[model samples]
Target: MALTREPPAATVDPSNPNIVRWEDIGLTLIHNFITEEEEAAMIEAFHAQDPQKEGKRRISQHFGYHFDYTTFGASETHLTPVPSYITNFLPRLPIQTYLPDQFTVQYYPPGTGIPPHVDTHSMFDEALYSLSFGSAVPMQFRMSGPNDARKMRLPKRSVQRKSDENTEPASSPATAEQTQANAQAQDAEEQSACWEILLPPRSLLLMTGPSRYGYTHAIRPRKTDVIDGKTVPRQGRYSITMRTVRRGDEIGCNCAYPGVCDARIREEMAARRDGAI
Candidate 1:
């Protein structure tokens, strides 16, 4: 857990018009982070890769490093280098101190979603970025608790277009002022239970600090999402998550949230057991 290098800054500028900052949780969303053509190319590249035939609900591929889900650990050995399609876009991301060497590309079909969990702190560095494209989805975030985390499942309901009689109008792209106003309103209404945010197609989501370490994010399984009181249909979504791998003597993570930091928690437990003996 010793310092291998200076930690990268996790701060985001509030003045950036494209950024929607939930400062309280250290989450930021950047709209239109990539061009439409770029998104298409990435999606095509993902398809070109041989698909996994394990009958898994979601399809995923890893580059640079293969992450083991059971252990929540990354292998020290390197895999295939990150393809040019993904590496080319890394420079444009906000992260400046260190470029990510590991990335995972996932394809989510309609009605399929991931369970709530945090990225293992000891495995990667701070500042994780996920670029989403091909469809829009709503991600739910909640503070970690002692109880066993459950997969979120919402009842499937029929979604009607706003133009239909007696239905509310669909949400339109808001001006910067309106977006800020809406975010402020939601801030007041949302409590510690959970907060939901829409991830539009071609948007980039940045998670660092508390958001990256202390909370769990998940997507509810559903064919459609209700946004702004209107129903929006879901489509296949492709997300590219990039992270800097922690290697060598710095493999253990040292962070402020010891309760959540895997390395720190293990050390604390071992020390307590030794003292009792």
Candidate 2:
């Protein structure tokens, strides 16, 4: 008989002194990061715009630089000036050097969800921030490299992992053979694998470091979310994703995240580094 293994559960970051975390993933959450009024104002701004203007899932705008949605490339379009509301809000956060030059606000009604994807690396800076408003929903993340693929979930409201005695800790690094075996096992188990995270309304989630490069995030299509055995029906949910554009030359990148970087530029940099060209 084949042995069946249980999928891993989401755990609270024991190492982080702040809000709960998912193992070593570089995710930070701040509950009630925005006031009810602020949330309302942002939503109102969204409502004020023509929904058809940007298309179905979301509306996007560029501040210092524009991104062409169709071609998925940086556009030469005129820069849209950042509004006072955004300018005023920047100083309120602890991020001293972070400034967003691009923004995307997505609306999700019932029965809607996004496929898992990491924000393109070369197109945007390292840190990406998102603010959630409206009703609460769960967001899913899965690590893609090395086929290690661990699944996790972010539920609505607050959530915490249980004490060490009651939970299984992450496994130690494996040998080459063991790693290959584990990868095969995980691939077969992935359909049922996921860790749950509780996200409250009006919370701010920051993705940086390994979390930004190593994981793909998505939301599953469903009408309701089950948390603690309670069913929470989906309502209108709005997510505002803010990122800084990676400009050309000095403002551009030469980062390790080659998966999302421009192939031409990356090749040129690599050639230069190796003195091959």
What Cα-based lDDT does every candidate model obtain? Answer: 0.71, 0.61
Off by over 4 Å in 1: 1-15, 51-56, 148-192, 272-277
lDDT of 2 by residue, 1-277 (tens): 1214232334544664345444466777767777898888877776676444233354444554565564344566756676564666677554657677776666776667765666666667777888788878777766544333221211111113323211223454446686567556754644444444556788777888767776666777888888777998877778767787666763455655554444434566689899999
RMSD of each: 14.1, 11.8
Pick out the ten consecutive residues of candidate 1 with the lowest summed lDDT. Answer: 148-157
Off by over 4 Å in 2: 1-18, 21-23, 51-64, 70-74, 146-193, 250-277
lDDT of 1: 0.71
Worst 10 residues of 2 by lDDT: 150-159
In terms of lDDT, the best-performing candidate is 1
The sequence of per-residue lDDT tens digits that candidate 1 reaches over residues 45-162 is: 8888955523436788999887655456676664878898887877888877757877888988887786566777887888888889989998877666542111111121232211
How well does candidate 2 score on lDDT at residue 85? Answer: 49
Clashes per prediction? 0, 7
